[model samples]
Target: MITAAPHTTPGVLDGIVVADFSRVLAGPYATMMLADMGATVIKVESPTGDDTRAWQPPVREDMATYFLSVNRNKHAIALDLRDDDDLDTAHKLLAKADVFIENWKPGGLAKFGMDPEAVAERYPELVHASITGFGTTGGAHLPGYDLLAQAASGLMDITGEPESSGQKAGVAIFDVVTGLHATVGILGALQERQRSGKGQHIAVNLMSSALSGLVNQTSAYVAGGVVPTRMGNDHPSLAPYGPFAAADQPLILGVGNDRQFRQLTTALGASELADDERYATNPARNAHRDELRATLETYLQHRPASEWVEEFRELGIPCSEVFSIAQGVEFADEIGLAPVQLTGAEKVPTVKHPIDYSRSQVAYDKAPPTLNEDRQSILEWLDAEEG
Candidate 1:
């Protein structure tokens, strides 16, 4: 288990207020980042609460871990936008908020008068961010689900083995990446607001984010006119850059350049392989990857993966034995990454923010809230809001 950092640092967004009309992953993750940075985030849920509230089985204190994962450091309140009184409450919250975020289907909130365009018009100084499955162009009507976005954006198509069916990532990776994009957009808008004295609408969709997140995979198609297929553990352009079998377990290698490849071969007691014309350069090594893998595995299979990992790491080659999630957390802890943070009075295990700020570290005191847990307090605050 990862150890927690001392949760006493103040957030950079200390005075910023966020009206979080988002549920599930993308929007909530973005708002959670803001909340951790000291924004007072008021999560405005529907009368039934966020959909992930019922995503259980992996529950703590009878609360869904799914909900807990991305909803921390924020207040929760239920509101029925269909009702005039609750709608008024939402309006009040948004009016006083510095940032507003939602993931309703494109144009879904137009009826509620809180769509991106409407919000931008009504609150010209408020940062409005909208997350959708697709943009408001030809595909706006489609719902935004991670799996659908992955398949539609060609991420799943390039994911697993070339011979096997497409596979969705282990996690809702596109959703998380989209969330990061939304957060960056919001922050950029906030910074620009200082110069323009006005806010702007920040739009992000899973499909767009997924396509962009594919990075080199999509680039190979768009830039090089090469439609990349799934290579499983094999990298399309790199040799000795995937997992090989050891005596006990699988070991991953990342020989980024010819220099690293040389270092790897030298460490493996196969320095002669580096001098071979077919394995000399990266492109040549990639062209002869099958033969190289067979040769490398012959030496790798002589020892346990753990032994190779240590020796290869010492030789400045990137390598590791495949680790389970639990092992991953333990390894991070051992390396002083402090991957988990204990938050709230109950001290729940939450992932720490990955970035390390020199002046201001992330704050993680408050836990994820229960449904409508702060309704009375939030309403009181909104009731006291000035024009």
Candidate 2:
């Protein structure tokens, strides 16, 4: 729920035009968020289409799910940046755009004269968001992808089940996170543009976001002289704070301190265990976690995960039954957490804006666009601009 602050909408970025020259996840996701906040995003695709357009499996309506998942409420236009005519058209849009986002390989866009530096020099008022695999700095030449970044940042070294050798997350978390950072950078630059009447160059990369996301673990490793280990399903400092097998399914429980620990034990009909010397304190319980786990399992085996969740919740312990993906979505909906959505006007797939603004409404009211769907209208506008 991190939101752009101090700016109430008419939409914070209202009336801004974003020339999106990015393909795939990170860049599209950033502009998607901007579009949700009232920016006009015109997505430019090559003749073969964005790479994700062909990535498939859960295909629907002849469109790539990968493409649909991130892109919506956008106007897509086919362009060939290497072609003089196409490059001319892009520059035409750039002249009037307030933001430009691109994720070409380092120097890839430069070869086509779409480099941020070159464009910025020409249009100092346009905010430039450059998304890259590796940052354009020390490791600029190295390739970057979400999984690669997870490994490079050492997150994969501590992510999965210990037996599984800490793997990359199933989802491309780094890419998504990097996109969010890029969005934030764009918004910040937009705000700064208000004061200076000129835009600044903003860049976001997967490596930086992945590293930034390793917050607590990174701090402990850097300052406490400890290399983090794969804890698997357990919290490093909390006792009995991971998954436990119940009769029907696994449940996750968090007994923060002695008080909650006592309540949890009571709920499980093992009151005396709470008073036991080795289980009486958080540290002690953590030290004897296996023993405590065995005790909890012996009791939990008598009830389903849902029952246990209810019992622990009633007793004031932080606990929940592990849910399947569908169940999680249903639960989010049931509790007023909107997850899926359709953008108005275009009937496009859009997830709910993550931020809940009390004063300013999100800008999205339409679905993501199809490839080159708005080419006619966009070109018409660009054509009319010369007049």
Candidate 3:
């Protein structure tokens, strides 16, 4: 099991060192983002490796795709943190790290002497980011999982049809979003550390991230007292903003404003529909959504979704044909988004980091690591003095 950092590009986070003690989705995803940007991330796994290592049925090269998706660009080692010698190694890594991340249960790291207060006291300049299922208080005892966060955050309740059972999203969306949040928080803290000359504790939890990620749905309740329910694919506040049937399949029409609505109507060869008093404004369109949908379907039914997608797009109306994950990737490639890249020994497929920095770009230097593969190198590095 070899882990080699590719030498093709420069990274923005080139000098930063991260001591990663996270497993599963949220924490690993965040650290991976850091690694992509040039942080030297040491992923400290347990004796058996991260739990996602066994999450199979979707294995590539006998490796769980789940684990592969988020663990790239890092050096990995397995250690029994409970052992005195192994715990000392972890402490040595932390002493040199500019950032430290973990997703263990609240209070779980205290027994190993890695608690927030202790770490801060030991290494005052180390930025410590903690990911939990819940925060460190009332909900601390409850284990965090993506499904539980979705349920507790009211996301599931507003996901499906009003009459149907609440449905979780097709992916672990909240966990992913939480991971992004954690990345943002870590970066911000690092920026501030430049001036403060001290590190701070950053905490992110699945439930809170779910609520924040809900955005408009949560806003309707908190700001307007509206307890929004599932409208299926239809948006709660916008009309002609969901999937609509075509001659052969469903195409999504996202008329964000009256101008887009007019374009859509003109593209459908039904310009008069856009001028109707009942559908002139966004508010009016929402009020008359059912009628508007029916009128659009009449025109959309004349062509397949692909044809309509082209015509509507040419007219500057926001529209697209529904696609599977593979198709979505193909479309991205077709449009020059370059959504994926191959890295490391197996030439594994990895999704590109979402942002494109012109001057200091993200680098796909290392592929996802194998268990204890970099143990000797990382231990030797950590044992050295400050540059």
In terms of lDDT, the poorest run of 10 residues in model 1 is 1-10
Per-candidate Cα lDDT values, in order, are 0.89, 0.82, 0.89
Q: Per-residue alpha-carbon lDDT of model 2 for 1-387, expressed as tens digits?
A: 112221245665667789989888989888888877777788899988898888887676887778877786577899987789989999998897889898888888787666877878888998988888788878888876788899988888887777776787878998999999998898889889999999878888888898788888888788898888888888788889999998988999987889998888888788999899999999999899989899899999999998888767766789987778789888899988888776666566556778877766675554556767778888888877678
Model 1: per-residue Cα lDDT over 82-148, one tens digit each: 9999998889888999999999987779999998778889999999999989888998899899999
User: Whole-model lDDT, candidate 3?
Assistant: 0.89
Worst 10 residues of 3 by lDDT: 1-10
Model 2 earns a TM-score of 0.92
Better candidate by TM-score, 2 or 3? 3
- Quickly count the clashes in candidate 3: 1
Residue ranges of candidate 3 with Cα displaced over 4 Å:
1-8
- Per-candidate clashes come to 0, 7, 1
How well is each residue in 1-387 modelled by candidate 3, as lDDT tens digits?
A: 222233456678887889999999999999999888888889999999999999996999999999999998889988898899999999988998899999998888999889999999999999999999889899999888999999999988999988988999989998899999999999999999999999999999999999999999999999999998989999988998999999999999898998998888877788898889999999999999999899889888999999999988888888899999999999999999999988777689999888889888687767888898899988777666434
